[model samples]
Target chain A: MMTAIDQSEHHAALENARREFRDQLIDADLLVPSGIAGLYGRGAVFEDIIDGIDRVVQRAGSAAHGSGIRRLRFPPVFPRDSFEKTDYIASFPNLTGAISTFEGDNKKHRALLGDRDAGLGWDHHLTPAGTMLVSAACHPSYSGLTGTLAQDGTTMDIYGYCFRHEPAIDPARMQAFRMHEFVRVGTPEQAQQHRDSWVPRGLQVLEDLGLSAAPVAANDPFFGRVGKMLAANQLEESLKTELVVRLYDDLDEGTAVVSCNCHRDHFGVTFDIKTEDGEPAHSACVGFGMERIALAMLRTHGLDVARWPARVVAVLEG
Target chain B: MMTAIDQSEHHAALENARREFRDQLIDADLLVPSGIAGLYGRGAVFEDIIDGIDRVVQRAGSAAHGSGIRRLRFPPVFPRDSFEKTDYIASFPNLTGAISTFEGDNKKHRALLGDRDAGLGWDHHLTPAGTMLVSAACHPSYSGLTGTLAQDGTTMDIYGYCFRHEPAIDPARMQAFRMHEFVRVGTPEQAQQHRDSWVPRGLQVLEDLGLSAAPVAANDPFFGRVGKMLAANQLEESLKTELVVRLYDDLDEGTAVVSCNCHRDHFGVTFDIKTEDGEPAHSACVGFGMERIALAMLRTHGLDVARWPARVVAVLEG
Candidate 1:
């Protein structure tokens, strides 16, 4: 078993490596610093690579589903009540994004200004807008699809500007990230089939992009004692799988670039959605962390896109 | 010399027209409502049109600036200090969006659950993240480009999912909408020239897309008495212009689909960006409200994409 000192040392080393990679990216103008941790701007080169990765994934999704897949776009902030139904705040309250806006009159505004001048925070004046920033690409999709579905169900290509409150220096762990999710909502068999098929297909997508990747049984970092039980059950049932890549050679396991999950009928029951057979629809989604996958490509191939493999370049640059 | 009753009637009529247009969009399934005012999810058709409009704007930007323009992408949020430098809150306090997240540990989480269970909001448990949701496309671009520039100046294509606190039923005014900005930063001459040229060029771009638009003198709705002075000064200097379109035929004036502003030395000095001459840069940008323009298109044409004129359709469909 690892001792306390040994664990601290390991964490230090891991952080150093992450910092080193971040410095390299900043030096090459691949990333722009925003002064805040986990919040960095994407330079032209970095955005280009992300664009390439997006195209690659879009092509893959289209190839598999054809016109069956439809793109769903949502603004980052969603209705607060919709978020409440998901109970995401219960497990990940620390990472939830709630919008606070100035809702006061002129008198309150003057007091806010006074607080600002006095060097005190005026955050209290900014009341909650009754909306929460989207934490996942598929979260907002459910509220829009609340009624009934067709016989075979629906396939959606949902993209969201996701937010998480974990501020860190790791380039892979951005506070605000983009998640591209291929979600299937329908019968239990269909949901399972979608997740099962994506496990290999997702690994292949990254492999084809010239990254060494593998599928690993995984569970989300659920919070608290009850969360521990949920995670264990989730792992035992193989409800979650992650396609991970070795971002750093020194690391034992890989970082998850893609997460494939079968949520059973949790969302369907909560959102009041039913399948063609009149039962609660089972939902499954394969979410691609667009930036993380691109970061892996940068680490494996090189930061320079022109120097990447010709085959990979063609797929991304298209 | 309209009576108070007349004014109220005008507002009622305008709201009725907005509701009518919204109903049409809903029936067509082009716009997906999130059950909240101003927040929406774009259906496949709506997304396709947005894609088309983006391509059209991109083509216009590229055709004018060539490789001289670079695309800058920022997350939906930025540092609170960075926002303060712009002094935006002083003028538009009610429209600012600040992020709040749960910062408490397990003990606090338990208390939070208690409050939530008691039907009282746990907003008090959440603290400010020191990052505000982006309100403009070009807001975050300044902090990243805080340094000397080339002799000729720099041009950038920036896009942002912007937010404003004002929630409304008018389809043209989305609380969370996109702004596609073609920005130029340099000498005073360069900034003015950029804005002046775009006054006509921007109109043409929209007109080509078959939007019945025209440029009119405009001013931001600044807060209170001081804001009135700012607005007057801005108007006197001709610092702001808007490309407005008639959302409803009964309205006296059109709604702004695009805003062209010359923030001369305002952002440059604020962000500490310098031009080739060692003096502070002057900034100008033509911001196209993507959804508003698309809405204008839908109003001008029809809700059905297939029924739109071929010339107009080609501009957006590409």
Candidate 2:
């Protein structure tokens, strides 16, 4: 008994079936358009199915965090005072972003080329290039995992290029994407047993890459009116979940492509970290959403990955 | 005889040997800073030598572009009117970047939380997020190679995540980076024989990736005083070259990890792209600079890629 694809008529028929599956993946060239609305350009067989779903999500996140999950990466900009100490602009200040520039000189680059030749807008000669943008690929690995955290707690394997200004037409609501995550941290019973074992190991790695998924109980578009009682206390304590799939067909609300979360101790008290007994560490994470599972494997096997499913292209070319 | 690492005393002894090789790559944990100044973070042995110099640069760009180039990736923001039709903000407006957001509502998000509680800065409630950051990994594949071309004039390969605000201390001057290129557009004698056959096949692919490169004739930091006469007519029409390398030790000037250039028809008269007998097509590219060849393979193999060089780690793990 669940379905609220956002206040009614299946949100404009799930946004006209995600704008006709993003115009048939930009007419089969596998999405390339960059004329704004969510910025893109992937091609090369949609980046060889996002590099075979990024090497089958790094061998299913190193077989669920064993190779001492460390990897890092980052670079979609960060550090504007470690993104304002992750108060995340008070809960997604309309999906934040910042990186502005033109830090002038030469008489302010000749009045920024005379306000780009009198259009009166050289973006007020830009500014705050102390960086920001990355809105979460595990928010720059919780500022390099602040401090302490050993008693069975520690893992990262992050990634990056994330942003959200929510411009949509649902090519998986991109406004710059890619995520990858994994995270973890520690204690609170190993962060709820590593998010209850990645909510059924992320629906068995998105149903071993061929689709059919589930999970649900999610929440976190949280912002405004005390982020609606902190998104109903993060869905009455379930602490976010996601996974979901239904890439469109009969869309009774799915599109999450992996999440998990858990965050109790909210990034170990905003990264003072702790744990191995000194308490406060519990973080979690999961993530994925790499081009929303390569647009849910080009909306459930089609935009030619040489005809998708043969044991899902042998576990994404094994 | 070229030592202008900028100004001279060999520019503060090549920035004190690139600040002691960025403090021995942030003391061997292979750089993960991000407290701004050319942001960092990239561990797992600095991303496995940047994924083994990105698979020996896609097998030296598919053994020099045979598999019909065409990789495309782009997503470090672009399309702000195709970035002002590549005039490149009148030549690198102090290294560009744009993304801004907080598109108000909820009473401008409580006046952006009362300007972050009167520190008075909600970045003027952001705005122009039509995107813009990537400064070139072949600037969004010349707006998808605009129009005509096919008298053997097309290539592309491409790649991305690039930005350049030049806040340095020479960790290869990264202000957000990564590039890969290959490009070529056609007929101005195939863009001057593809930048004169990649200036000696890019110094023999950086001496088969063990570094120690050469090839100079550069020029481009263009901007004022009529961009110093277009950087002295691009070094008297050599139209850019680069390659360079000497990562440090007694640095007599190097570091310009592969460039090449040769935009003979200035991107076919700014993307009107044409060639198969239509004129206007001549372009070129080359690029590379992926994390300045992973900081010259950790300044010539030291950051223990398991004690590097076994034929340059078997051409980067083959």
> Best-fitting candidate, measured by TM-score?
1
Q: For each candidate, what is the lDDT?
A: 0.89, 0.81
Q: If you assessed candidate 2 against the hidden native complex, which CAPRI class would it receive?
A: acceptable
Residues A16-130 of candidate 2 have per-residue lDDT tens digits of 8888889889888888887667778888887777777778888888987778877888788877777877788888887888877887777888888888888766787878777
Evaluate model 1: give its lDDT: 0.89
What's the TM-score of each model vs. the native? 0.97, 0.34
What level of docking quality does candidate 1 show? medium
Candidate 2 chain B: minimum summed lDDT over ten consecutive residues — where?
A: B2-11
Worst 10 residues of 1 chain A by lDDT: A246-255
Cα lDDT of model 2 by residue, B38-123, tens digit:
78888887777777777877787888887887777888877777777777888878888887887776778888788887877778
Query: How would you encode candidate 1's per-residue C-alpha lDDT over A1-318 as one tens digit per residue?
Result: 989999899888888999999999989888888888988888888888888899888988998899978788999888998998788878888889898888777788899999998989989888888788899988988987788997778999988799998998789999999999999999999999999999988988898899888899999887777678989999999999999999978654778999999999999998999997789999999999998998999999998888898999987876
TM-score of chain B of each: 0.97, 0.37
lDDT of 1 by residue, B152-260 (tens): 8789888879988888888777889999999999999999999998888888889888988889999999987778899999999999999999989956599899999
